[model samples]
Target: MLSTNPFALSDTRAPLYFSDKVALVTGGASGIGMATAELLAREGARVVIADRCRDDGEELAARLRHEYGQALFVETDVGCASSVQALVGRTLLEYGRIDCAINNAGLSETPVDLIDASGEQWERLMAVNLRGVWLSMQHQIRAMLDAGRGAIVNVSSRTGLVGKPRLAIYTASKHGVLGLTRSAAIDYAPHGIRINAVCPGLIHTPFVEQKFGDGLPELARTMNPLGRIGRPEEVAECIAWLCSDAASFVVGVSLPVDGGAVA
Candidate 1:
């Protein structure tokens, strides 16, 4: 069991839980993904940041290597099978093994009635949010299976647990993520691999700020029991714990890091 409460952190100082391990974080250029990468690196893990944003990804990887430890940035479009495969291959080429993976690359569509949603938009969202996770897991699980041990945390959303008006496609995609987590967990548990999902509430990420603007805080207050928005670091802490030995007994759980929003 984890001795310290993950939610009570006041700073970034964490135990070296992932020392010498290699962690792969998709969508690691910004927001929740970036925070998770930073946390893992700080805890002594060599990190590979895979994302489509070349500049941001490269910058983050450089910062991590200079300030923390070994880090690499691989330009990846998770929706593309080739890109995801190269990402895994590159990680192995550089680091030799993958011990942890955070499938955090996802996108959200503008809120619109189901009837008003376009087939193109829905397909686009599914490609990255749903298929992306599945593809990443396929390769990640293969590597972990070879090593006989590993952990995975897929980033879902609060919307995955409940229906939200005007977010039909996004909700469906996230729900799919949870389903994948559970089924994969069952299949891989005996193989020494753990798979789980983190359903985050209205986290205050750059993407959220751009989407919600000045009303973001108020909207978060109205939506969650905590009456405020969550920080990226807050969500990152949950992801880190789920990937660590502290959560060895935990598997296939969709943890809600949402400030009681779902409750």
Candidate 2:
């Protein structure tokens, strides 16, 4: 049974670990991003949701506000520098500081052989999956630097660490994300900013469903050693922990939330 009181389950270590903080979540209208934003709000963070999907983003912000006090939505295109800068600007303007940030906006495609992949495909994937994370991080780090302390969790993927059969472009993009995360972590850790990446396995999100379709069940059973699809909330839990003070000493690590598949 779930607790009726939202604060009751925020965390045992700190019932309100994020109380009086500001969190920015890109791609926050759905899936793992949505879960992270809601979790942050439950823990008392003033949440700012950024996504190109204006309707869903605004709806989520409204719901969070009704339940948790402060939440706002900003439509953003992570691939665009100006858009990301505006997102960070809006966050700071509305909430004063960014104590935590999650770069979750991403794009993937139907798997295609490396030999047949087109330059256009590569560009699209790089724009959202790689460049997007970089751009979001660039602006986010600036805000965190001014605030003097913060945590950032970039949503990498299982493809980040290993090659997928026909997902060459996506794999490459995710790998780039991990690279950005590590180097940035090193650059900013001394300044009290912790940067890390989460590599999620076959999570049962709308994306996974759309990609797998009728084969999802069988794919879930074989994709990971756990023989099941992971939940967005599972990844959200890991992300939340990384953003919290409990992970204070942690930095520059790529934690796999892959149901032992990577092992």
Candidate 3:
């Protein structure tokens, strides 16, 4: 097993579990993606931050470089096959192989009942949230298959497990992610690839701010058993562990990083 000491990562000498590993995180410009990228880089992974947010992506890559880690920023539209292909190509051109990948590029739509939701809304969300993951894994898995080892973490949502009013399209997209994760996990596990999904609840992110804003306080209190929204880093921690040797035995689990909401 590719193991590292289980000490808290804050310790400077904590074994660099991901040292020399090449990690690619899509949607890495902000939110959970950003947190995961930062954690992976801090732990000694050469990271590629792929996102449409060019400024944030560039700035983050620069910061990691300054911290003495190798990082690259690629502006990508995950929904585009050509774009995602170019992303993997660029990563391989620079680093030679892909050791880990997190398909986190997703967007949410304003709440709308399924009946009232327009086809345009559904297509747009599915493009990024579902097809994007599918496109990414097709390429990522091929790279890992050649390398003989890899890990993939797909970000879903609590709604993927259950249902919520006025968010049917988003729910479908997330649920699709879990389906992709599990089936691929089963297919590739014997090939030395571990695939899993993280279903996060209401998290405190820029997306959340845009979605809930001033009502966040009230929203947090009623949303989950923990009575508070989750931090992006909390989900990032779960993702990192899943990507590590610590979780070598884990596969195809749609772990709820939510505050016991699905319970």
Candidate No. with top lDDT: 1
Evaluated against the true structure, the overall lDDT of model 3 is 0.93
For each of the candidates, give the backbone clash count. 0, 0, 0
Write model 1 residue lDDT over 170-237, tens digit each, in one string: 99999999999999999999999999999999888988899899887679769777789999999999
Writing each residue's lDDT as its tens digit, candidate 3 over 139-228 gives 999999999999999999998899888989999999999999999999999999999999999889988898778999998999888999
Q: Give the candidate number with the greatest TM-score.
A: 3
In the range 101-174, model 2's lDDT, one tens digit per residue, is 99999997777889999999999999999999999999999988887989999999988999889998999999
Tell me the TM-score of model 3. Answer: 0.96
Where does candidate 2 stray beyond 4 Å? 1-15
Q: All candidates' TM-scores? A: 0.95, 0.94, 0.96
| Cα lDDT for residue 60, candidate 1 | 100
Query: What C-alpha lDDT does candidate 1 achieve relative to the native structure?
Result: 0.94
Q: Identify the runs in model 1 with alpha carbons over 4 angstroms from their true place.
A: 1-15
Candidate numbers, best TM-score first, in rank order:
3, 1, 2
